[model samples]
Target: MLPADGSGPTLAIRAVAAADLAALLDSLPPAAATFARASGFEAAAGSHLVVPEASGGIGSVLFGLGKGSDAASPFLIGKLSTLLPAGDYRFESGVADETLAALAWALGAYRFRRYKRGGEGGDGPVARLKLGPTVDRARLESQIAAITGVRDLVNTPANDLGPAELAAAAAEMAGSAGASFRVLAGDDLAAGFPLIQAVGQGSDRAPRLIDLVWGDPDHPKVTLVGKGVCFDTGGLDIKPDTNMLLMKKDMGGAANVLGLARMIVDARLPVRLRVLIPAVENAISGRAFRPSDVFPSRKGLTVEIGNTDAEGRLVLADALALADEEAPDLIVDMATLTGAARVALGPDVPPFYTDDDGFAAELAAASAAVHDPLWRLPLWMPYAPMLESKIADTNNIGSGGFAGSIIAALFLKKFVERARTWVHLDIYAWNPSPKPGRPDGGEAQGIRALFAAIEKRYAGA
Candidate 1:
């Protein structure tokens, strides 16, 4: 949505609050001000008033900031990108966060039209934002591309984006960035990633461990692990039809890490980057591993399958174990692992857990700075007992339903021992409803904040 050339005649978008409406009206042309007043525009949040030019064509637009805290949101301006007609536009006033406002504009302009028939998906020209020189054009563009890629990947259906396709996507990205790409599947997967293999064996589609490595080997190591469950039919346990509807986004964790990896590689961040994704489909068949089955993880921990539906953490356990082997400076794993996380923090804000307070603080600041909502949840070692299994070292799920998100994080923590710092992001990855910059579909949640934190820690190293 960012246009490189700002030479054309562009409409100015002025921000106005309820208290500032009178001042804005006084500044506008007489006819435009009269029309605005006649329209009864109160400058409410997400509300907009278009002013007409002397020639009756569109002139400047006044966007509502509402009152109080809503006025400070950086993404509030994102609404204009979709609301306005096709043309170039620029902000006439300052926003809370100019960089994020620009980012939001581009994000808001995104439309997933892959499966839409001609003329059905709003294929018309889109409104473009003329970014100011103060913004980092390259960084903003890279973030947009990366986040858009996440949305696209998560939006794809299971049949089209199975483990094989997911691995191919990672390989393509790695090749483009000059990173080393490897896949462990078939016999190799069974031999190495037992947990990843156990979870995907139910589906006809094979399971794979996708590995991508880049940057200087001597630099500080940062490992990212994402759960790539292409589809979760809940295995033999099965899910209700309503629950199964959005299974296509089960791989959202993988999509996010790939997005974050793209930003890091594109920016040429000075750290050794390793991305490990366990791509699988938790389908049902005779080959599916049943409940109470025990699987040896890559980390050598025996995990009892308490429920087949809790498959995300199983695959992630193997990948996280592999990631921890090198004892990277930081190990961050993102997964749509539990409904408890959604219940606790909702879909917009994901909950993250980390034992390292310094890293947590940095992440918290980054989250606030970028407007990527992330709430830090305690690891809660006292709840670790809930994962105790009679037959195995641990159970895939907690003993009861209490603190499910924390329990899942604790289970993952069992696999990660050597990392200097480890963070787990329990993300929903889907927007149930449209808001400002975020649309009603797959979303890139914690990566923006994670990228900011990682860049701050290792940019010059």
Candidate 2:
């Protein structure tokens, strides 16, 4: 469904019988013990197993969904490709949560086929899973499309997904919603948004601010700013080779922002939605902005580049400043800004920065309920000094290596004073390994959490 890689097990599925198994053959019926044995495998409720002929061997597999675990176990079905024998298969029992099941099956079917185009992931033969009756075909298609869009965006190389391409992608989304969209690029970027221009100046591709607006002007304003360093070569301050490998996902914040936007617009949320992306390429070149360079931001705050690698906050500062100018009811910025964030909280859990206690609590609760998962790290005003700059208003990098994530949040906090409520998320957005509904690569981390929170907040209104 979601991670549709066209790979999965092909098997005949049915409820197991007591006589079907090796040991419980005489003692029990097929349905009772089969579920308990593979309980660890997580079968959905209403799922069943296949009992092959006594002589031909147990040729088919079983499926029984356990309790609904939200969307957490979608990837569990991926194991079907590995576990099933090399043969074509079909489904017997239909599941109520068919969308999730299809998504799980697709995710379980994925293999990164980049290096060896024709190579098999393992010695395991290709298995295909056929659909059963209890599925919503229309809804299944839509969810699959949304999830696959995220995967494709994440899978593309940085070179192919640079600033220009990122803008084009955003424009495409805007068009889908019939929203108004425009971009300030090149010299225009400097004329209106100085900070955006400064960070993007170092790269060959002109940096730009992408703005997309939709819904009634009278509606509550909700603004989203995403850091889109399509490719972060660490600018003048380059990262080591190992660090650069996954840098392709540096734009993960942008990707996830768009993913969240897609969900909002698709659901026809009543708020006035504005999506802002400061797209740039952090590359080492003669034109790249260097450390210690003081640049003027859209809000007219002068920022000194303490480290070229700290460019994400710079671009976000300019965009967030613009979002603040609107004084939106809610402003949120997502970024893969700091390795320190990952180190402090680890990749699985993202830390949110916000001064609003109620908003923070809601986000935490929503994240947990949806199984999207997030953690709240303090804004910690005491660490604000780490961003002090002798020449400019502030420095992008922290003076101390410790508390780096908190410092980065504080730096962004300086530019966002207008919104009634604001939240900043520093997310890994990538799953290092496979989880149930989540795959190993690019993930839509806090989107669902934010979606749930927003939905709950506005449900009565």
Candidate 3:
């Protein structure tokens, strides 16, 4: 959190690395050094020590930066937003990336209080950061708002955030950005997006194809498709209680894309942006599409339902097909589609698939620069046979469990033929535990890295 104006008496926060702690203490005033020495302050990452003034009031805070080869990330400073007392504070030194540190401070201050009575949560007033002139205040605020929007949407219970509600949220965002928004539901949705309809037919709420277009038509076209499985019960193949606990975050992909779209629109990137979300709920009922049932997709490809739990890709397939029809300069789709990705890279790093090496390089560079972890996974053609179907053109899931993430990527690749470049992101949109700048609930995984790459590619075009 940041203050509107730096007019208050702010406490100075000095970041000291573990190896530099003794030197820093020696340089400090005698009383302060003695206090720190007595306190046994070792400068471990995320650890802090508070010093008192001679008048018995607050003086300055000593924050840790860890040691070499284990130095804390710039985001580690985020911990200070909640750790420090409710007062204005300013970083005195030791932050390498000021902008990112400021952004982290804002992100760390977020709390999901929608369900809390009277919106009462947290222990006390949040610590406010006095951002320096080097930090881009507007940009940092926009990033915070966008990311928190994703967390809010994903944290919402499925009972309150069905396909219809998700569409409404997208419509609201579009209206605010002066973009054209439309939702195809009922007969229109069934006719246009058969895969989307099939996935949602079991739910009473019905499905929707949410479309939003913004920016100048003459600009290079960039389309984003997100899997909006509002709630995934794994259909007839019901998931066990343990796996079902976090199903509310099934639409995290949709939430993330909307967040990324907000960033692009706010920054006014020079590109025609189109967002497609096939909002659905994969529930179990007599009408649920059965395993082994064959269905025709929007792209004219027939798919066999190999497994009901693989419904995220079913909805995304239709949306990606629709996005590819225009043969946009680029097509990027994000989905919380597979656990295999998490098994491979864990929750902190999501795997992305793209054929364009140049664009992949740019994404990798941007990812490292922004600290948004993304790893490139091959769309291995060798795994194509695993998705073979006996009756349909292909199966919704692979014949074997190996390379599941890659198989999912290959499956979506089939629907995108016209786009000059296409990228698929398999994201675990929920953080399992609280960390610096990232809380335990829903997260916007790859949007920042994707935005950086997009901005670089199209900002000057």
Candidate 4:
């Protein structure tokens, strides 16, 4: 997987905190010191430099980390993937947090090259990292593969990643893992998952409920449901150009679920895994389900469409209802459900709602441990009435402008009655700007923390 030219010299990487810059420079060889001085290498926070060797070749890269970024944050060293020369490199000494750093390196090296010609471009030759003995190769490789899977799926354009294609991707992943996969589409979708069909009927392609099951039947059941609205044109409630720009990423929740499933299956977690995705496109058409339309859901709730733009919850409700029926040990549902969540937590952090304090604690601890930050928002029972519909059982959206994210979670909570533990994540899966490890496009938010929490819960059993 090394992407550099083999003929170039290898370099050692040294991470220096701001306070240790002087000592770091003093400890280097005289030649290295001279190169640093000549090159104007100031070891400021988030800065870096390349020192030269006595043999008149490249030496090492010194990275300034401010206070050392914790092991969970793999992004601190992420910039080096493209910043360094086109050669293999390694850490100067044994790194206590080798696995995270290695994982960061792999993640930073990602380039979505499907449409971009010449592949991921670099200023110089593309750099490669030579794996050290301390690095956990298996863990690093698996994470990179899974995260890349998420990025690629979310990155693909709506034309390429429509509901049918998204289902194919899930089936492909399931087949690779030797898991059983099934799809309910067209007549089955209409008869069994009417909400999924209603939301997707606007599109030329048919809607589908994609399901994949893995692990032993006797294992603890852990189900995942994702909203796969491939391109949300806001249905009859059409969105403005600015709002519709990144709608291709509306299916990020589904992509992330698949990514997490990949991690669980690869690690052979004890839990029986079931992934349900309501793959659809909230497109505009003559047959598009409109506002004020009330539809019977898979859970038997009559849902009134307060606004057609609120279709993500409709599809997810059906999938969540199906998952809930299994009464899984844990039911986790993720979606690009609301703009209010982005307003509350921003894109970097997502707010998840769950009544179970123990599950919340585990998730919070895992999030903190992995630097995949998440916040808990309550399902405030008082605001539950906001989803009340005059005609139907409940409206898909709250009438008031307040507590939008909470209201969305509340609307979903109604459909899920049997699952012992249900956690709903209202995720804004798009990253508005570029940062280390995470690029300025589709992001897999909270999946790592979710995986960490799930692993902790079922590690031995």
Candidate 5:
């Protein structure tokens, strides 16, 4: 883990003022001034003016990030990662939202070095900044750790982060937090979690279920289920080469659940926490579960595999069933389960489903407050008929691809009826492009909103 130390220099960050432009220029040395002029110094979102000593050594730096147009919109300092030299630096002007800037700085400092030939350039000094007096140290640290976890997990390849490795990662966190960790594999998984066993049996690495419990048993129970397909070859319905290129990030939902678990346990939210991950690799092999094959689930429902590519929901069904059996106060599952969701919401945002109005309202409020983006889609009871199977309780995929994400949610909803509240997030955990605090690749989409919702629900109870 990188040292996420919140230490830096005192930077004079303020919104750009026209009156101060002349003084700003006058304070610059000749070379920096020329560089600034050449680089459009006075431009918003661009930096200017390096104060220099008589010996020509660089002193303090000045930069711009524009005035705030919307209160919620991040006045991001992430661009500095690309524009500045390797030496230490900080924002001199713009919105002085120190926590936001600090987060941006940390994100800007991120580099995905998993597959690269050489390691990160030798111990380069981090561009540091003294967070403004208004900084919330604890909050900043929590968010950094959560986001870093997502990045690190997503950046690693499937070869390195398969089912066993993912379980080990969860166990590491559980041990640190005194959470009880239980993993069921091989014959136990085959007998107890058939759907999970069916999907993962094709791979040399055995399939398993990762169950983690923490907090007091007397507290309200909250269960989280994440689809842990370490790699998705789309099974018998194999994906094209281009589609499989980034399949390593297919376990993003599992990564997200772990990230949210960290936030919940570290904050000690007043609820009993349980996390269920059906960890597996949907690899192509002679014994891979085939299309039209029916398998019994933990809930005792038999599901006919309409498409092997739709394996995520099968594994999730078993896990959700287990979650529901506990009759928890709340059960929420996250998965990169459907292309329809990505087609509907695009890459950055995830669409959530829930039947509980109160839960929906809380999630919406959290989504707005934390800027962890999510949109609520209706359960749309009318679509439930599409999953009906003649020989079994249900079909994994619908007759047509229309409303695919909705149908998948409906299928999982079938396995989870005992919980007081249930919600499902259909997430595309990869960022198609880089942005302020979010870099491209495996990103955690909804943990912020979920964390906020859980905190408010359990706070002071």
Candidate 6:
């Protein structure tokens, strides 16, 4: 489980709704009232005010809960930590939604300072919270740690987190979990993952397949395959400058899988787990794979490249094939596969694909229970012909526009044949702006809901 700092001073907290502001403030001591008025504090949503004591020392922190009628944002209270002065704080009174508030507060304490100058954010609060039975602190901490890990991996610039680096990170995580870790890089990756090798051949960093295995061999098998395109320049079909800027986050699917793995491993779930990350950098060079090129995937299917920019599915197809060969009880593949997905569903809500009705229903319920929503887009077979190839078994891209996201899912679906259940998530993984518990930059998508479903499904296994 994730660790929390539990060592600071505890300050009483009074959460107030905008309408109840005057009544609540009137109940406070005269000096505390004066301080709030002096500060011109309005009980706006997400607004907070720290009242001072008669001795000029720190007093209670009055937090705003917004208008009483509107539905509260789950993470609205996340600002309590960093926004408040560094210390340990505890809620003075109980609230209806204690779990959401506590979790939000913990999530807001995240700091990504990998490339920051020596001392920046050094003095930031190591915000600690003491919560009551409303929130399970240990479980919440583990979730926070997993989410933060995903953000850290996605936030790191491509220079420090290429193919080998991404694999090394996963290896370290698996090592700590006592899981066996293996990697096939360079020439070794060529034989088993041809499409992976083709897309990554342009970069100096060697493309690698990272494999992690854990739990009893006889347990029900669960496999996770993530597209680890560390940085995508679109190969010979290079993207424009603005498009290339956030390419570092292209490997977000891989980051997310590792995050989910952390949660499972830490909880000691009763299932055999296997994680496959085909780490690579799709760069531009003399030997870069080109449009119209055909490559044999691990499934032995010939894939014609319609667009080099669509390299994510190529790597995933090969990795998914290997996972299928194992005939796992469940296989889930995640990737930042298509902009069409973003165009259709936007950034926050990701679209998912799965043929199994039972698994799809389970995912929907789990997503709702955890507030990590995913839209079920059709795996419409009519779009199947859109991935036609004149001389090969299939095309990496569809015929044209319209349903591009679905087409990509269909293309990937061609690779897996034996898994008992399979699901694919097309995630944005990048948050555009800071909002409550979620800060700007890399964010984890759907993993919480996915974890909930997995834990429930294999509970007695």
Q: Identify the superior model by TM-score, candidate 3 or candidate 6.
A: 3
User: What local lDDT does model 6 show for residue 328?
Assistant: 95
Candidate 1, residue 217: lDDT: 100
Q: Model 3: number of clashes?
A: 0
User: Candidate 6 residues 158-191, lDDT tens each?
Assistant: 9999998998899899989999999998678998
lDDT of 2: 0.75
Candidate 2 is scored at a TM of 0.82
For all predictions, the C-alpha RMSD in Å is 1.4, 5.5, 1.2, 2.5, 3.3, 2.4
User: Candidate 2, residues 1-461: lDDT per residue as tens digits?
Assistant: 23233456445554322233334323334544454465543345434444455465655566543453422344444455545655666544433344455656665565545546566454445655556556655544544455556666776788789999999999999999999999989678888788778778878888889999998898889998888888888888888889988888888888888888887777677889999999988888888888889988888888888898888998999899999998999998999989998888889889998999999999999887655679999999988888889999888888968898899899999999889999999998788977654668877678878977876775542
lDDT tens digits, residue span 239-269, model 3: 9989999999989999999999999999999
User: What digit string (tens of lDDT, one per residue) describes model 5 on residues 1-461?
Assistant: 12334564343433344445556666656765566567666735544445454566665566554434422345255555554444545455555466666777777667787566677562456545555557776777787788779878977998899999999999998998899999999889999899999999889989989999999999999999999999999999999999889888888899999999998988989899999999999988999999989999999889999999899999999999889988999998999998899889898789999999999999999998776789999888898888889999889988866899899999999898889999999998888888766777778889988998999998742
Q: Locate the minimum summed-lDDT window of 10 residues in model 6.
A: 1-10
lDDT of 1 by residue, 1-461 (tens): 78886578889988888888899899888999999999999899979987889998889888999987878888888888988888888887746567888998988878787788873356678888888778889999999999999999998888899999999999999999999999998999999999999999989999999999999999999999998999999999899999999999999999999999999999999999999999999989999999999999888889999999999999998898889889899999999899999999888899999999999999999999888999999999999999999999999999878999999999999999999999999999898998889888999999999999999999832
Question: Model 5, which residues run further than 4 Å from truth?
Answer: 1-11, 15-39, 46-60, 66-72, 86-93, 117-123
Candidate with the larger TM-score of 1 and 4:
1
| Pairs of residues clashing in candidate 6 | none
Overall lDDT per candidate, in order of appearance: 0.91, 0.75, 0.91, 0.86, 0.81, 0.87
Question: Which ten-residue region of model 2 has the weakest summed lDDT?
Answer: 16-25
Candidate 6 positional error at 424, Å: 0.9
What are the models' TM-scores?
Answer: 0.97, 0.82, 0.98, 0.95, 0.90, 0.93
User: Tens digits of per-residue lDDT for model 4 on 1-461?
Assistant: 35333445568899876667678888989888777778776655557887777776788888867654432255777777877867778877424476777777777777788886666553446677877666656766777888889989999999999999999999999999999999999888899999999999988988999999999999999999999999999989999999999999999999999999999998889989999999999989898999999999999999999899999999998999899887899999989999999889788889999989999999999998877889999999999888999999999988769999999999999988888899998888777887877777877888889999999999942
Can you rank all candidates by TM-score, best first? 3, 1, 4, 6, 5, 2
TM-score of 5: 0.90
